[model samples]
Target: MDMRTPLGRVRGLGSTNDGVKHWWMQRLTGMALIPLTLWFVYSAVQMSEASHAEFTVWVGTQGNPVLLILLIICMFHHGQLGLQVVVEDYIPSESTKMTLLIAIKFAAIVFGTSAVFAVLRLTVGSS
Candidate 1:
């Protein structure tokens, strides 16, 4: 069967939707994290002399909430992306690849949600 037509090899059947938005979002989030991560590291270093109670108080403070939330979101987003890449690279069979992808996504969602809930509980309960 001839795969090419006068239009030249399915050239007219381009993607019905674009994925540039998703690519842009991933890059934007990554860019946002650079400064956020540096701020977090600096904040942590500044708190090195703090006692355990003081450290807890610092984490529960209003100033830290935005950073903490960003950290949580970025950590999970990066994790999910990494796992997906791994699955795509290593898994040979299509069925197994899909199963692993779903599993990874489920685990990421569960872990991220639990972590955020725990942070919220600590911060809110302490206040």
Candidate 2:
């Protein structure tokens, strides 16, 4: 038996089919960020008083560059997913929603790439 309410039937709204995947990705990235953020805070506090060269040297240390890149990727992706949900939930206009989603994705890519490149450059230069 068809169980959709009259309003649901009229609007023709239904599952997007990818909501579970989206939810899983968001949760996984959030879980990954927990330890990453803790490490970042601890490192920041440890190096709070270090000189510029010392900071660069730390960034170049074994596994530090990789962790930093992972941090950048996860942070930007998490933020993009969050903003996408807000836009989709609050914005009523389809065109505006699509535009904002594109912008969010673009900004995430640009900023994330820039962060990763900066870390790589520092790592290379420190050697």
Candidate 3:
């Protein structure tokens, strides 16, 4: 039973387009997160008893900043993708959905940028 209207057919939404791209991205981020998260957990455990200065020095080490930045980006982006899916599935009102989605994206961008900036500052500032 086709539930779409003539306009929907013209619109070419749902799985007809865009969905595959979103699905791919979501999966890719998830996969990326696996190793990144494991690395983070291992690093944290390795640094469990370290002092703040030691942690700061560790963050400033070569490659650590880049890895931390990548972690921040992937984590935030993956979270935003999941939130978007939930909003799309649960939210019924179009206007409300769009607003929430926009807000979520904006928040993610803001927080991601802030985190990256903090990492860069800490890693570079003390150098």
2 against 3, candidate with superior TM-score: 3
| Candidate with the greatest lDDT versus the true structure | 2
Q: Which stretches of candidate 2 lie over 4 Å from their true place?
A: 1-17, 125-127
Better of 1 and 2 by lDDT: 2
Please give the ranking of all candidate structures by TM-score, highest first, separated by commas. Answer: 3, 2, 1
- On residues 21-119, what C-alpha lDDT tens digit does candidate 1 reach at each position? 545656777887898889889998989899978877888877786688778788777777667767777888979988988998899889888878877
Please give the RMSD of candidate 2 to the true structure.
4.6
C-alpha local distance difference test of each model: 0.76, 0.89, 0.88
Q: Between candidates 2 and 3, name the one with more favorable lDDT.
A: 2
Residue 127, candidate 2: alpha-carbon lDDT: 53
Residue by residue across 75-99, what tens digits does model 3's lDDT show? 9999998999899889989899899
lDDT measured at residue 93 in model 2 versus the true structure, 0 to 100: 91
- Per-candidate total of colliding backbone pairs: 0, 0, 0
Clashes by residue pair, model 1: none
Per-prediction TM-score to the true structure, in the order listed: 0.71, 0.82, 0.82
For candidate 3, the per-residue lDDT at 84 reads 91
